[model samples]
Target: MAADDLPDEVPADPALSASADPAPSIELLAGPLEIVDRITIASNATFVGRIGETEVVYKPIMGEQPLWDFPDGDLGHREAAAYLVSEAFGWDIVPRTWLRDGPLGVGMVQLWQDVDPAQDAVDIKPVAAVPGEGWRLVFEGYDDRDRPVALVHEDSAELRRMAVFDVVVNNADRKGGHILEMPGGHRHGIDHGLTFHEDHKLRTVLWGWAGEPLLPDELARIEAVRQDLDAALGETLTAYITVTELVALADRCEHLLQSAAFPHPRGRTPATPYPLF
Candidate 1:
């Protein structure tokens, strides 16, 4: 795609949800027509253009000096770590995440999944009862014959578990827009910039499994993460994560082992400072 073919600004879509009060306008980053516009989808993050058809999510390098209070650009780093760990654990929920330069400078890019709501029906009431305000983007998906389908299902066991993963990682921001129900039975998780704090900040909609035992496979996978920490994977984490943050990551693993449970942090405020959709 030629740069000239791309729009100077991304077309605003009401179907999408964002935390930016005055939604940020999309802009071209330095690249081919690869990335189109900057989109603010959550309170603290934004999704930019595509890298060869894949969604490129650009979260700013926020710090005490910036309006957003994320520390040392650690949020994005933790998300990358989470994706690396999740992939190693054999979980297929998180989208492929990688570090890249974005409209706001350096950030992360993720894969986008096509969601057709009608074909994959989900229980919405439980999600509605999720005690927060979030925008549910209603889009139409079609069959080859042009049949219409809305692919938003809030109640699926697989989706619930992916939510669990977010909490375990101390994800402070999980909204309806962050959960993508893709075509052909796929639900992808995104916007993982807020997670892995020293404290328990598991705020998400997948609380259905709170206090439940981790499946044997899940526990085994956790053990594998513990073992892999000392290898090159640990080096990779060290590259981006501060020493304090790395220690916090280890503590979460220990907490999981001791409780034989997924423990929500005591008295930690909402992962997101405010409601986001």
Candidate 2:
């Protein structure tokens, strides 16, 4: 779809905005749920629903279609693990995601985020040559009518932080649509089911910072995550993924700390996903 044709931004549900503590929101996620809409384009069965008064996205395991590259029926757990990593770093990139038993069966439920319609930070088309400022050219391609096109994205601090997080998690599918821009300029990332694989698989659109030195704060966050891995992150992820994957996660942290630079594509697979958006 053209960027201009994107759906209107859904306003944040009032129920979640009422409290800052988040305990009430957690309760709502666990409370009785009712489906309000089904999202048909997703590879798996996904729906938008209300839990009590809060809005959320639910992805049931029973709805998953098997992928030869990923283990079957475990995408929901991976989504939750992504949230856990985001929480550990205090990045708040991924939405509040958790595992629960839904009407369809066990699944992952995440708080629905309302994006800012005015901003096109995640996905935008340039009218001419790539903008000289605040954007990075990802690749050049052809549109449907055989026209030359350049794919680029925002070069903002929030997106840079998310790029760091993606490297740590080995996120295999960081599509353009996965990045959400909230009303107050905050960005939230979602759709993390294709992440945390034991092997390296960090395909993404936020390669603007690739090869750049890590900022001091970014380096500090990496160290903090490394320190907490064995105690908190390790324990939390084991329930969802294998121990080997957990070790791989720690190794990724250490490698990034040593390198202190945004990584270039490994070339083992396509650096970017099939559908850039």
Most accurate candidate by lDDT: 2
- Least well predicted 10-residue stretch by lDDT in candidate 1: 8-17
Name the TM-score of candidate 2.
Answer: 0.89
lDDT of 2 by residue, 1-277 (tens): 2212212431122223344447755445557778899999888999998888888899988898777778557998888888878887887898887766667866778989888888877554544766868888777777787777777888888899999999999999999888998888788999998888888889999888889999999999999998888786677677777888889999999999999999999867888886878
lDDT of 1 by residue, 5-86 (tens): 3233321211122422132222222243255665643556565666544455566544212224454545666667677766
- Model 1 misplacement above 4 A: 1-33, 44-47, 53-55, 60-69, 102-104, 119-155, 271-273
- TM-scores for every predicted model: 0.67, 0.89
What does the lDDT come to for candidate 2?
0.81
Task: Identify the leading candidate in terms of TM-score.
Answer: 2
